[model samples]
Target: MVLLTLWLTWAAASADTTKFDVQPFKINLGSEIPRLHALVNNTRLPSKALYGVGQDKGIELDFLAELRREWLEVFDWEAQEAELNRFTQYTAEIEGLTVHFVHEKSADPDAIPLILLHGWPGSFQEFAPIIKPLTTPTENVSFTVVVPSLPGFVFSSPPPRANWTVDDTARIFNVLMTEVLGYKTYALHGTDWGSVVGYSMYGSFNTTVRAAHFVFLPFFGPTPEEIAADNITLSDVEKVAENKGNLFVSLGLAYRDEQTQKPNDIGLALYDNPVGQLAWIGSKMKLWSDPRAGTPPSVLNTTAILTSVSLYALTSSFLTSVWIYASNPNGFSTTYSQAPTDAPMLFSQFEYNIIFYPEEYVKQTTKNLVSYKVHDFGGHFPGLDNPPALIEDIREIAAVFVR
Candidate 1:
């Protein structure tokens, strides 16, 4: 009787861990490419700013014009789609929402399961470069990489109702990792809004989420009192990062505020306007990255930028994607929990990112911080800016599992 009870318990647990019904997906922009080009060709550019201070005013007229010309003349959506299809893509229904993701399983049977999360104005494309390397078995480690498109971004469906907070996203993704994919344990890495979701999982699903890594930490800004505390001495590098962060908060929060407060307004306005979508996301791609990040002289490669903008326009996800900010307006101000999470945490700080968290601030916010790294190059989108470094950092965090 005792043996039967134990067997039943084990059977139930195994049954609960069934693999998700994930269907193969491919990006086919057959007619959409020509349609996009037509819109780009028809777009009427505003006159060049009279007092042109360059990017300060917004995406430069000449820059937009050049990009428009490329979109209309040189950019090939079909080719780009084919390249994107190189990775195995799939969509699974989780809580009535269709979740789109790339699941690149490592050849090694013992590979670590790792989920990579991306933020707004970015998608699973952000992790394209690192996917192969992470999947390739190294002497020390190998990873089965899963990159999910946050709901309402690209292929993923929008929330069934409005006001889907980061916490909600975390819950759905937990289902994706554990229940659907049948991973008993996994690690997470994220940037921008992705970090918010990853943090949510780390805090809420401690039993399954063993470790997490982030390039961005939402709602973790240091208080004035903490900054002014006598024990903390600011290094020159730290001071520069702090000053840059302050400047960004003062000048760069307009987009965030608008997105959070009045998403429908902007979403409606830019819903059908492909050029408008381009300008909205393109400016950030140009400004937020390290100038020295990409293969092109400017950090924002024209082709890459266009690819991201096209995805938004093609899928009509701009409005719903921006709704994430509105859903969690108080997220940045609200503490995730009363105490720090027990799950091991790791953070990577880039110098030119919009916001910078000093080592002290990160240490204070994360209780079980196993690693904190500062890179000379790279920005908010470190995967695109410096993928090798990002991969290496992920490996460093993964080391904790073995230890």
Candidate 2:
């Protein structure tokens, strides 16, 4: 991302804001909410440009062609769509923007109230595979899950103005939980952009959020000195936040830069070439997932990788996802911007997508952090990769907060 001079800004103040007033649908017996019937029409990615992996990216010719062919043949957008709409969804207005979300309530009435937020190029749809496990852990800790589409994401509308940073979005989510759902106290978690939003809410409604759990939290808390008494080993897996990440982002972050600094321009091309889109995205999955371990397309084949990777693409969320970068270039501005948005004050190293933070440097940053939990196996998309494990982890974490 290394483009501090620029970060994705919300749609220009001057850009037209399309307003759609959606009414509520009776989703659950007593928990009905408004559903937006907004339809997007202006998208038209350049068919040819999308066919080629950016030559400048230096991808091998064969891989690029393979990427293109697979996208054209293997990826099925229609199936992805039907799979998504299968859930009960709704859209609501917040802060001059319409937000789209999928709400899944657990049968356990006493289940903890929780909300899941997604970042760029990802929609609520990504959580589908893991939904059952998380919502009804072992059919035990049931949760009324609310997964919201970040503004400009698949189902949500873009901002009418600029300056929609993590704080801005988190503020809205806070309202949604307390006002809309009437849950004054709940758990908030997120991935990528959702992580950032979760961070903001962690403080914005610190009194309410029981404890925030993020698979990709960037900010630092402890120094080895502080946690030395407890003695926790900071593994490369944990340091993946530095760049290698649990299973994604570093290699593909450059694309985030282009979106931040020149999103409109990037979008102009990506909108058309679904092939190009697949290549750009596939390249990241290649680098993040063990290339030597799995098939050429590990993300497409493995359940977790496939679920996480395919989450948004199936829904054509790329449009709204990139718009986040296009709108707030600053958030995704650093090569390491992929790092945590929450740790503004922590002296962190090898942070996000940009310049590699190196192993030792990352080791230095997370030394003393308390409440630091590390896991094995699950990559960028733990929920998709091993929902049962993630669900167990969440259940354990939530036990402290649930009354």
Candidate 3:
């Protein structure tokens, strides 16, 4: 009887080792880097714009040229890869798909488990700067950080079937934290499309997703008329944010529409073309980042931009990464419904996020609103635009809710 029980234990462990092997990962583009350089060298950009050239005209011709030169001559993918690999990373089969993630466990036994998600045009690299800070022991608190490459992005496998949604990804991640990593309850922070998936987990997996923090949400806040009717006055900063949002709707939605309507076209066109990928992805990275980047606290710079473009180009996942837009037409247009969770929720609003959710409208979506901080800088990508503030905000949330 004792032999039978021992055999059963060995068999279970063996199955787990074979089927759900979580192995260390290293970023090795190998020959892809040289090929990428060749592509950049051979590329022919449009003759510098003759007239009427500006931000409204789309990515500046001169800027694209600069990026092309940097890609061929200055950008070092190997160095960037080494920097990224400094964190503990691994790949495991989750939900029958290969999932790549950075799992940095804190030394503190009671540290909070926190998952950070990234969105389109961004990869797991979005949270790279904050991983060490979050996991290191601090006077306030620390986190056992889990940063995953969203399905169809970077190292992760693309969705195996059509119509895969953020909620599906959320379920896989929940299983990863609870069953795979053995964390019964975890906290999460998300931005851009990450917020969409994080919201799903916060609302649906409330039993395990104990607390949450977000820089963006999937739903639209109250319309201007609704705000006026409710007598909700907008602050000067908020008014500026509202104007920027209106600009985004009018001028910035072309990429969204193309990705939504013709995912295959853009995907295939830029599949093997590294320069094209740089222009397409770099434009957004440049435009959406804090305008004051390169200054203190905002780390968005040339190397960061090139590294992002390289990740998409070298992974060969550029084509599949845009699948999120096409898969869910209403992904970002979700009506403001109450997030069905009593877990404490916190938000950090950045000045240049393209949209603003007034505190009143934000409160309407959740029962437990613990914190809402407004920063004077930072754009859509807070981790890149304002890493210090972003790090501080996460620490604050963990101290209050996760500790």
TM-score for each of the candidates: 0.91, 0.67, 0.93
- Residue range with the least summed lDDT across 10 consecutive positions in model 3: 9-18
lDDT of 2 by residue, 1-403 (tens): 4243122211110121233333443222111111101111122233444455654364445654554444444644445556666666767776778777776766555567778876544456557766666676554566778887787775566766655677788888887776655566788667767776776676567666765565554332333343345455555644544334422332345776777777667666665444455556655544433333243222224332333334444345565567666555555322222222232212112222222233333334333222434444444444443455456555654555633
Best by lDDT: 3
Query: Which order, best to worst by lDDT?
Result: 3, 1, 2
Candidate 3, 21-70: lDDT as tens digits:
78889888866887888878898987867674786567888988998888
Kindly list the per-residue Cα lDDT of model 1 for residues 241-353, writing each as its tens digit.
Answer: 66667767767888999998999999999998999998888889878888675663223478888888999999889998999988888767525342245778888887778
Candidate whose TM-score is highest: 3
Off by over 4 Å in 3: 1-19
Hey, what RMSD does candidate 3 come out at?
4.5
* 1 versus 2: better TM-score goes to: 1
TM-score quality measure for candidate 3 = 0.93
Please list the residue runs of candidate 1 whose C-alpha ends up more than 4 Å from where it truly belongs after superposition: 1-20, 223-231, 234-236, 296-300, 334-340
